[model samples]
Target: MVDEMQGERLLATTEAVRLIPMRHSEARSGRRASGDFVPFPVDTTMALAALTRQFADSGKPVEVTFRKLVHWIRSGERSSHYLHPYPGKLLPHIAHFFLANGTYARPDDTVLDPFSGSGTVALETVLSGRTALYAEANPLGRLLTAVKTHPIDTAGVAVALEQVRGSFAKSRARKPPEVVNIQKWYSPAVIAQLVRLRAAIDALDAGHQRDLMLATFSAVARKSSNADPRFSVPVRYRPGDAPARPAPMELFVSHLSANCARLATLGLIDGLGEAIGAGNDARSLKAADGSRLADGSVGMIISSPPYAGAQKYVRASSLSLGWLGLTPASQLRGLEERTIGREHFAKASWGKQHPSGIACADALIAEIAKENPSRATIVAVYLSEMRSALTEAVRVLRPGGHLVLVIGDNTVCGRRFASSEYLREMLEQLGMTVVLSLVDTILTRQLMTRRASTAGIIATESVIVFRKD
Candidate 1:
């Protein structure tokens, strides 16, 4: 081993800051709830620091036994991951950790993510020389994920950018689609730019290039809209607080330039490993079936299922969806109602429904039903849906394949719901055994203090592993 001075060079250098909420941040602008990374709980950070250096210096595929993906609990994403802004996205560092530790997966095996939000897992898998498959329910999410993960040459993206500019200059723009309460979300001028951008993207033939432009358009639309896209749907702004719209072509080109430069680093996955994906529900991955994975073909599954009340994911993307004509505001209500974890139960019922075999969840829900029956119904709806999701995860995984679920625990009327425990019980009923578990300290600023529990807010997330055999 090197002496003290030389050893310092081997460790990853990290900047530490207080985890408290502060001014001059995304939280301050009300544009985001979670702030930048801050080292926290001292011990976890120090332990993770040591493990990260070991993994980094190894330079070979890592074994899961010694992996500490929780290190990324404070590590925000960088590189191609910056192409799109998605709330609650799984960090690329975490995906890289899990894939490296995939001892069950052989060199030629495939990795799958049923809820591949923004394609972090798929991108990491393909880049690491393993094939991957993705199924994301939100169409906008699928578009962003595919564009972020796919690798197109700089020359092709440049040509597509020029074509978009030419289309805008030729005066061939389409009319902006109308929706109910449109003015409340976007100003008339912003709508005009969205329509123009949409027309330009449509000018290109359907391909990755077109999709990438649409993804760029999605980002531009969010910036140009009147809605406060901080946490969830339009956090109604004060009359004078409406955001100013930038010149469409200039804004789009600038975003394209920055993203293209970042993507040059991600490039495309090398070797024969490819990412095959489509917009489809994770509850039913019918879109992912192919000659490669026809019979329980996926060797590994890593995902972060939608957490309860995290955010109305579809509503957050309404700005992106509106520009694409994927869903109108009037119709978006119905669309969100049909998706899991996005539903709002009208006039509660403590209907006594529970996720089958999850006694801990049922018990917690029952306790909440005693205080406020309505909240209990919400609890039941979320966990029952998680059961269906986990069942689907089990179906696609090979008999010996592994499934790693990243989730957080939360509360209902001060009664704690240990999501990891409930999920473990559910996995056991599905013929899987719990293999490993870790509770990573949450380094994010606590945004939902209103939901704080008498047991104190859940300040950690459980990373649970299950193996089907």
Candidate 2:
């Protein structure tokens, strides 16, 4: 039998192991050698024990009884630990623990994600048997979320594909603009066939249309682009790298059919909630000021905000966004504002000056000096938006509700902005108590290395859990 002191030590040791960059096998081996660590049969139990200890150490009061800890550990042990196969998609394994631990639950709860990129949280919430509300400012993002969550009828989708094929055969007489584009990416004959197919899909009734079309469109957007095959984001086109573009019609049909098959396999056709695609600003949130939702209304909040200075989402999705009738020109000027990075600021400065000219140089230098002059301005904007979002979340949540926010840090001009820390401060200022700050290895890695280095960032991110008092 383990005594209390030994148990605490074991929990601490296990948590330390979790923080180490080792595989599960390595952790097990190390634990065995350490002799002070308990051999918990399940990985999640070990993880939970670490998290519980972390919460206690953070000076946040937790009233979880000993029985609850045991139950939580047991529950985690039974839960699946497999990673979702989708690379760009959110990790289901991480989400499951949050859900099971009641991190997003209330007496009566509705989940909301303001920056709901790719709709992972929203979809997961719905799949986990809860209602979710998702709002995204980007149209492409909104469309992707809408398509993923919308239900489909496999049988109807198959019939639609067949019809599209037949229509493509008949429409060979008349060509669509997409056909010309497809010809650049695919063989001429393949392009011709695709054009016909797209026309058929376009002819279909709007009410019965499935997300298969959008998925197909997205698929071809990659295959038929003039951009580098290796690069996911669309960059300036280079010579000889351009593949034969597929005809718009053919590409659309292919995209539709392929996605239909994938959706059918996933068996996610029914019971999906409403997912709207609108050009709303995150700062404004399309809500009246001072509107507070009923307390304890929301169950969870999960999202990945824009990286400090990485991908230009609007430009990257220009082709797809255009196809979906969401042109960047239509979005707000601020929405199109580039992620402020060190380089961007430098470029703005360079644009304003001439070499060796006093006034010209001074004016150019002035613009450069003004670069990121408003760190507080950006923070204020983000905080104001978040406050509105939180107020709504708090109103909707029942007493003792939880909100889980995952945000990475940003670095500008060599200064690190601890975004999560700022968020913690802001939430506390708004009367919420910090609950758990469990750091995931993958997120930590990306913030500290990948995103930071690629975009010249100098900061790291922290995952924060907050509860409304």
Candidate 3:
């Protein structure tokens, strides 16, 4: 129900000084070097030279103004998108608007989303006849995206559901998974039933049926668990705050049917192009055939990368990951360490103390670190990883091609952090020119984050567009 309020447009600006060579805080702090904060300037120089050669006229970015971005929460996401809800999931209409607009005007073009959570961008790409590359890090996200985008075998799905339901018809004894603190998240009854459903789905024939069934299981996994669906982390109930818990079977059946029905609208579109979904770290993205977007080949790069200290996918998806057997409870520690924004590695063990070469991020990191050293380390680690991934994004994009990122700022430890502005600086350093930066209102912040921040809780997010040229 969110509509555009008014029309105001502005272009992003960056000072070259933002890319100064800085000391590794980890080195300065006398800690062991993790090399996670290294930023190579030669790559930036080459990228900029390439861009300069591509656009000789201004060699600067072209800015566009938009008065509206449609509804950021619920506008064009009325179909299969509702099958699974994700924490801080991107809006479908936002992707559609970018695709429909001049950012990527050709339907035969190729699009990429490095952090393709739930495949919002990929789905929009194929529906518009354009192919997509969805490189995601989370296995659960990979499974959901694969099932959501591929053409469902309606008959096979039906048979699989019957088989799944029939297997559990005998009311056999069920044991909860021996994963980290299962009892804290689910009651004995709920845990037993969810495990039964998982075993049933896993035994099914290998095909889209099992895929769809697993997706359904993931979609409904939180229904019976203490995992707080409202936020990224599964929060247990507080004392005297017992929330209403539904039965697992009821949630699975209804959600599965709804997902199947919504998918019915898509016809066979295998010939239009390919919508490839690969699970890997966005920082090191690639295609299924070990292919990358050849240098200067991509039409547009669209994604909403992980926010710094904002969204934690590892903690958010623990229940389903354990249930799906993707990451066992004991092994989750390793996964958290690898995840972009996770607080797995201690600040003392951090490789860097300052944000990598971005002046704005460095200043903010310094300010936050002044209050709490731990928060500063978090900011530095998050931005360092982001710079690497974004640099790769620029490398694959064709000169003059636009890279549109949907991002919001953060207020950690009660300090204002300009996330989009910092991202703009990083892209600029990676040889990208800022085209347009539009601010849009968010209608559903409550569902996106567990608790509101003192800094207005991301009341607005910006769509920062950059061009390789």
Candidate 4:
């Protein structure tokens, strides 16, 4: 009877031990001596402990709550308004979160965005009164960043515009080669006017004056293209015998004027940081990897990397790339050859070729095991490149610096792809801790296809944060 009572007491004690929520420190210190170990934070510990108990009682693991985790990742207070002029490129509310949360605030801090698409983050960094180093592989994206971040003397811009108008009035010539292809997408008169404008801009002497002129010219490129601003594909004017679209030179002028007006509204002309847009690949950034930058050099890193096999950047920016003297064919072929995807992973010794190649192959193989091989290679390659970038970021960042990655999950061949999770894992492996993962409420209509819209649904994007540990 005494032995039986002692055994029952021991069993009861074991059950009670399993029922209690383990403290975070216990888990972190690895002091638990039982099979019922749970990771930190009282809430997480209690929830997980209860889950394990229920699972053990049922003889099965409880169903995973991936949706709940995603919800938790995205939950945050939204911002009310944007401080910059081009709020459309970046959701103002999201940008405000970084500012309010002290993600990009430092008196002597600089920010580096390896994949600075459209200059949203860079502009925000400058608006927050910090220096930003913006780089992009796509010429058009680089140009956009350069133009948006370039400082403008409001008075000087006005005088330059007046001079350009004077030059246009004096010259009466046919559209140049650069503006000729643009003609098919615009009205003849508009094309002629744009040609003259380009000439006038080209004639300007070197300085910020020239940059301002180029900025105006670039702002008109979208209007000069076919309507709808199809970012992923070519600007198709006629669809199988449709009449040629008319150019809206006046509309383009108005757009330029509005941009100038918006600049005036923001009063950003007084103090803007240097915005260099020279074409450089994010994978092989100009800076040396793992080299130490000045302490507290960079405050924040905000960027959106390329989605695997989703956007053929060089092809999408063909017109601009052509003008910038980067051959589209070479770049497209190179990107295709080097990008990660399912097919590349099947080939053995993929990583032996290039550092990115190995990562792409590994990612591809991992996804293939789960039967999602379509773009896994590219996603993997991006992860590898991002790892290199993160190393650079760490080298350049000050202590307690922040890095924000605006990313979206993708689906390939009807299978869900969790690129963000992979990125988080990679960053953590590099000794960075995830600070927060906020879901951005802004919805983008681009990149939605009928396949992705099956059952009329699409996956949302999230803004993930990481701090160097």
Per-prediction CA RMSD (Å): 11.7, 14.2, 15.2, 19.4
> Tens digits of per-residue lDDT for model 2 on 134-214?
766666566666666555675566566556556655774445342213334455564454445446667666643534564
Query: Any idea how many clashes model 2 has?
Result: 32
lDDT of 1 at 131: 80
lDDT of 4 by residue, 1-469 (tens): 1233342232232122112254545332222223342211122334434544664577432343333532221232111011111212444334433543322455346677777766766665554445777766555566566666654555565566556656766766564444224545555665566667666666667776566456556546544665336444455655663344434334334444444543432232223344444236554444334333444466777777666544444455555444333334445545445432212344453333233334543654475445443344445556666667666666666677777776666665555556666676777776787655555443555534234531122345667767875
Q: Rate the local accuracy (lDDT) of all candidates.
A: 0.65, 0.47, 0.66, 0.50
Model 1 — TM-score against the truth? 0.78
TM-score of 3: 0.79
Q: What is the TM-score of each predicted model, taking all chains together? A: 0.78, 0.64, 0.79, 0.65
The RMSD (Cα, Å) of candidate 3 is 15.2
In model 3, where do residues sit more than 4 Å from their true spots? 1-77, 170-173, 238-246, 268-273, 291-293, 446-456
lDDT of 3: 0.66
Q: Is candidate 1 or candidate 2 better by lDDT?
A: 1
| 279: Cα error in model 2, Å | 8.4
Quick one: best lDDT, which candidate?
3
Q: Alpha carbon lDDT of residue 24, candidate 1?
A: 49
What stretches of model 2 exceed 4 Å from their correct place? 1-50, 58-89, 106-108, 169-199, 229-232, 236-258, 265-296, 328-384, 443-461
